[model samples]
Target: MKISRRFAGLAALLVAGLLGTTVHIVTTAESADAAQTSLRAADPSVLRVGGTYVGVQSVGDNGIAVRQASSPAGLATAAARTVFTDSQRLGEVWAPEIHYDGGRYYIYFTMGAGANHRMYVISSATADSGYGGATKLNLPDDRWAIDGTMFVFNGQRYFVWSGWAGTTNVEQNLYIAKMTSPTTATGSRAVISQPRESWERVVGNPFINEAPEAIKDPNGQLHVTYSANGSWSEQYCIADLRLRAGGDPMYVWDWYKSNGCLFGSNRSTMMAGWDPTLYVNGPGHHSFVLLNGDINTSPPAGSSFPLMFHAVAKGTPYAWSNRYWYTGSFMWWGAITYSRANVPGSTTNTGYSIKFFE
Candidate 1:
């Protein structure tokens, strides 16, 4: 019954190839209930414009598939259309994120057939059209990089990504640098996070901490969420690091890791309503977006921030094909408690809760 992690990934891929379908069967009503509670599935990176929502997913050889709709419900049913493709990039394009800045939309993605992965960017005039050719992002060094995302803080634009410390592939860490422009880096890169914690060092790989996504809470504190562990294992999960409002982002000492993972595989049996078989598996590689309004009205209002990340079915083979989008709102109570309610611009003493679909 002992299976090697490498073999497990291979076996999952082989099964996927033979089955010719990505969907897995749910054997029980409890599993079905879990699926229903989960967000609509996709390999999603989502953005909302006015009333319309747009998303992009990794499509292997066909390139990044873009989907759009007026509502999240409609977006679930919308057919994907190929938006950006480079015949020269002879491999998979991974984790494409769409962002709007300076009167244009930009997409940051990872592309490579194998070990030589690098972060690339493309520009578009609108939210979902006129995308320009891809260009390699100007990093401080040209080692290996991926999962690049951008954010603005204190009126300065910055880019954050997962990259190798050197030419070697032994370790992957999260780095941030000031951006001279949307597609270029201006200064030295800061190594924000590495796989230093036991929880971050998953079984298959001791050196991982990739897929960085940035979010600014209402209090103006900066939070960066990144995926940890081997991407191919059920242990893959999301963790967070935080910086206070006036903290220096370039200073490594200014940021603090969350007490524990923000989301991931579950082993606990405390929840009476949760079937252990239906627990979320490998939930990481995520992006965050704020909803225009509350989706739940029963509590008068709910948090608008929802996390879009990929997860696999419990007990399923850990193949890339098995990864599907699942989103849930974040509970800020843990963050507040961890920060001792010192989060900026907050006058309340209440904790926040995530509103999952019923």
Candidate 2:
């Protein structure tokens, strides 16, 4: 992996202000429409520190677009500068996540045209530039895989993702493996989550559990939130799996599945009653980021952690092409609470009683 020295200074500056600074922005009715227009259907991942951010947008082999923003809200306005396109493998790229570890920035994503899907990694010296070549991660089994992300717990790094349980795509399950390095897996992979719940299984397709994203709460508890139901169904949504502190990530029995969907279709009274002006549907396939502060500047508050996902417009047909980027804030119970109204400073009320910025 190529390491860049420029990031060392920026990283230090970021760490110093990460927990102390709050970002505030005011949105008008027009700004909401602008936000919706900027949204995209792919898995959106962003790394934000103070006013600087690096976001990953999956736009195929032309290489993923790595955009830079001055502030968290500015992400929608920043122009993208493409990277890693020249080195991508023969197929398309999907779900790219950017991480900074050990003085280098690593990008993990899924690649391949069809049933040949697999996870690949590339490195850069800085968060926004100098991307190196791509390398396939070493998985014990070579079944279909996608939406790979990494998290560190107890000082050990682990890779988690959704993959086919067998050669056929009859079923998809969430898996984890310890990492020997940023681009290599060690030992056997453990099946952490599968589609056993009735809501998890789609009518025409195999059971699904994909788009795994790891989040650590204020109490230091570890949780992996994944998308369930079929991606094509309006019922497609997000769910959670919790791991005890210092527990074995490689053991399926060590993770506990939360009750019900954390975020899904219109199950809440607020969502079911949404007005046409404030409607969003099929909210899933998400990643989380901690915005420095609430979007409004008047109320100086602590960090605002929100889930970034894609949703279809209120009256649009449910299709991948119709999905666009949207964000919703969840109250931190022992797990995430997504069914409630807007929290004080973190979320704004959309018509559906969903506290998300559409």
Candidate 3:
């Protein structure tokens, strides 16, 4: 990847470990100020959801300024919009998920450039609109990374994100570390899993494997799923990392796959899936809600319940390029599906459902 002093100078890590490893923390008053100011300058009331995706286009040089969308899906389709954008005129927003906890709405998303991406959080009064500005999380490295997802387990919050080990783009590992506070880090980072398997390492330039999302199984076990391969080539794919209930998410763990491409097309066969986000619209990132009703609370005999997830993608699954940007590449928003066919009901799963407050 291209390197610039401006980018390298942004790293902040103290007391490097034995393996030339360190956790980069860049939480500063200035960055925090920028986030708050962004929220105050913009009219938070303007953002609302359209039918398919959230609709809030940027004015003039701004890109998609107010993104509001309607949610027919169970997740309360609250109105949302961008409270701020940097002077660079490039808006890097992806898969904005709102989680309601302890009577608060936490907005989580990935922000930053190619390899130097970081995850940030902002709070809001409600699940949809009136969101506060983002406070940058102090992650290990400040390099090419994005797609940081948040999950609450057993009353505690944990963060999962994709990061690179070195300047070389050969490896992208999924990491899980405990947050000391709701938005800060405390414990040592763990390399939960890497793209060592053949299915994960796609054949292409800028080889990568990242974008991890995790959900607890009915048995209280953790099933962490992430995408593998190049974002621009056909090697993009998705896989799962598994950990038992008592196991730590920070340690290296073995994962399971669906035995095939969770979602892909006839382009490069494997490397086509990017940014696999999961939500409970009834289905998941791989499945959509065909009908609305009282879902069967119990699994059937000799079989697992088929729970669906609601999701949105930065790009299409099988296509080599994107359509909207028209640059032979780009990311868009949409949905996908995954079936909890074999997972038991008591596994601590998110219930293939969503709860939102308007």
| Highest lDDT scorer | 2
Compared with the true structure, the alpha-carbon lDDT of candidate 1 equals 0.63
Judging by TM-score, tell me the better candidate of 1 and 3. 1
Residue pairs with colliding backbones in model 1 are: none
List lDDT for all candidates, in order: 0.63, 0.64, 0.40
Model 2 collision count: 4
Q: Write the per-residue lDDT of candidate 3 for residues 325-345, one digit (tens) a residue.
A: 100001111121222334433
Stretches > 4 Å off in candidate 2: 1-37, 86-89, 268-278, 290-301, 335-358
Residue lDDT tens for model 2, 1-358: 3222223223433543564422122121222232343655567787655567667787755477777776445666688777778353568888888776666778888888778888989888776678877888888798789999887766788889889878888888999999978888998888998888655664337778998877654445567888888888777777777665555777766566654565665463122212122456677776566432111121123434444577787789988888887644443432232222222221221110122333
Q: What is the TM-score of candidate 3?
A: 0.55
Q: Which stretches of candidate 3 lie over 4 Å from their true place?
A: 1-80, 87-91, 254-260, 266-358
Score candidate 3 by lDDT.
0.40
Judged by lDDT relative to the true structure, which candidate is superior, 1 or 2?
2
Q: Judge candidate 3 at residue 278 and give its lDDT.
A: 28
